[model samples]
Target: MSIEVGSKVQGKVTGITNFGAFVELPEGSTGLVHISEVADNYVKDINEHLKVGDQVEVKVINVEKDGKIGLSIKKAKETQQPQRPRHNGPRNNRNDQRNQNKTESFEQKMNRFLKDSEDRLSSLKRNTESKRGGRGARRG
Candidate 1:
């Protein structure tokens, strides 16, 4: 029951901690299934996915020189699903939107810029005045 990187092995969950689940491998060696490696989705708690004595199939992702074995339950399951090919449809639409944005009239862009600047300056003035006791009423 030799465990090597990239190999899948069946193990029993020996312990569950806040950070990860410890699994006892077939050869009596234990490996850590970090919280991130427990699932494809966000796992706030490892206990939600595994418990002590539960059987799990984990993939050996790393074998550290200090004898630490890193495992991933997610990677073992991911092997069953085929990756989808990326499509260019949404990317082409984004390019079209960029071109449309570039076509805005100079006057329209200038107006928008002026409005944004005015809003920012007013906000800055309000913040500064509040801290300075309305600008004129200074503390003794």
Candidate 2:
């Protein structure tokens, strides 16, 4: 059977790696499930979530022209919660800014970052100067 993108299929884990796990799909085809796509949360170690000979349902994310199939285990499982709409465009309107606090423009974000960095630098200088006996300490 040919594997298509966005289709869920059952497969057996044939091997495991630091980055991902290899699964043998139908018709003897093998696909790789990346470490990040193995679970919903952060997956530091793939071995903690999967092992050899384990059967898992994975969704085919991509079928490359080079015969490489990218699979995702998390996408195969159904979620009851509604997905939030992604904001890909620039948030220039008032409604977009009001809806999300992170919708600041490039200049606004740069100003905020500069102010925070200056504050941190001043605080660090104050602490370090006091520890080193201030500016006019006598050398004995």
RMSD of each: 7.7, 7.1
TM-score of 1: 0.61
Evaluated against the true structure, the overall lDDT of model 2 is 0.87
What TM-score does each of the candidates earn?
Answer: 0.61, 0.63
Residue 23 CA error for candidate 2 (Å)?
0.6
Candidate 1, residue 115: CA error in Å? 14
- Candidate 1, 1: how far from true, in Å? 3.1
lDDT of 2 by residue, 7-116 (tens): 88999999999999999999999999999999877899899999999999999999999999999998887453455654545643534655575777888878867997
Pairs of residues at least 3 apart in sequence or in different chains that clash in candidate 2:
none
Model 2, position 115: C-alpha lDDT score: 90
Best by lDDT, which number?
A: 1
Separately for all candidates shown, the number of backbone clashes (residues 3 or more apart, or on different chains) is 0, 0
Best by TM-score: 2
The models' CA-based lDDT, in order, is 0.88, 0.87
